[model samples]
Target: MTLNLFSQFASPYLLGVPLIFVASISPWLLLPSPANRWMPNRLIAIQTWFSKTFTKQIFSPIGPLGHKWALILTSLMAFLLTINLLGLLPYTFTPTTQLSMNLGMAIPFWLATVLIGFRNQPTASLGHFLPEGTPTPLIPILIIIETISLFIRPMALGVRLTANLTAGHLLIQLISTATLALLFSSPLVSSLTFITLLLLTILEIAVAMIQAYVFILLLSLYLQENT
Candidate 1:
């Protein structure tokens, strides 16, 4: 039997049940609960700081209209961050690596923002499709283009996350295989390959965090447009 480069991306199952649920819920349980303290420990403090900073920064641009989204946005950011980093651990599954799951999360939020825009101000929301002072000939074409782009946002979000993670995982798998294959045949080459693998692992960790931030950031931007 041989290892498949793509096999790691396949969703793991036990008996008849999908493990994604377990993978998703397990990370949250690890978070430390807040307790009475003059000052909390660094971990709790950092988490609190990030939550406040993210909430404030994300909601600032959108003004009061977007304040209601703070809870969902912060929770989503935390969830994504935890899930992504956890995947890097040995034998862990990454739910965000699946386009289906990403899109399932994306579409509803994207649709909600669009709905908010339309619900609050129908004229302004539709105005995004066409700018003021456009030539009659280009108006139709531009509107069509904008509409297409509008709908494409959710797909783009899903694919961006999936592609980045999948590519990184594949690359890591290939490099690790190469490193092992070279270990006996060429010690020097194997050492270099192992070093590269180490660097790539660090880079992947950064990517996991960044992709989560980008996911939340883009959602906030969409809400900004609506609000």
Candidate 2:
């Protein structure tokens, strides 16, 4: 009973071994593969449309140089979108809810962009630390602050994803628990709570999609600065 209540967010395991990798990769297996024929099915058509639309949205504002990232960014969004929505299913675990997992994905991408900027435009990259014509004493302070903020990007990305999913899951568990507890005690309250849960579920679905987009969108913004 206790396990069922919180296992949705906990790292999954059979006996003692961790099943996080399995849970994390399960979402991708559900996606449909493209057919070999000329004409495509509805699902393929919809997937292609979404990929194109998302790629355009992310790359449209940025320069053409960064357009190459369309495949990577779009695939990332699809992966996150799948895992997040799948987590909402009964008895399922969400890997994105883990801060470690999110950071693992975020830091490398963020660092790669920073490295790209350094490699391509060293002077410009360093210029981001200390602005033009800064006061002597205040220069150090500003550099320190900017450096800290720059490093905070990955942490923020991981925390943002982790916190949103964690909060939503916890709330759903709490509300659902209250609903079940009240089922026999108070039918009126239980029914209303159930309806509220329904609404919250819908909201979480939207949140899952939006969070995935936001993650990719921010990465694209970072890539824009470098590319």
Worst-scoring 10-residue span by lDDT in model 2: 1-10
lDDT of 1 by residue, 1-227 (tens): 23566667778899978998888897789777776998899999988989999888778888688899999989899999999999988888888888999999999999999999999888999999999999999998999999999999999999999999988888888898899999999999999999999999999999999999999999999998888
Q: How close is candidate 2 to the true structure, as a TM-score?
A: 0.94
Measured against the true structure, the TM-scores of the candidates, in listed sequence, are 0.95, 0.94
TM value for model 1 = 0.95
**Residue range 48-78, candidate 2, lDDT tens digits:** 8999888877899888777777888888899
Off by over 4 Å in 2: 1-7, 15-17
- For model 1, the superposed segments whose C-alpha errors exceed 4 Å read 1-3, 36-38
Q: CA shift at 167, candidate 2, in angstroms? A: 0.2
Top-scoring candidate (lDDT): 1
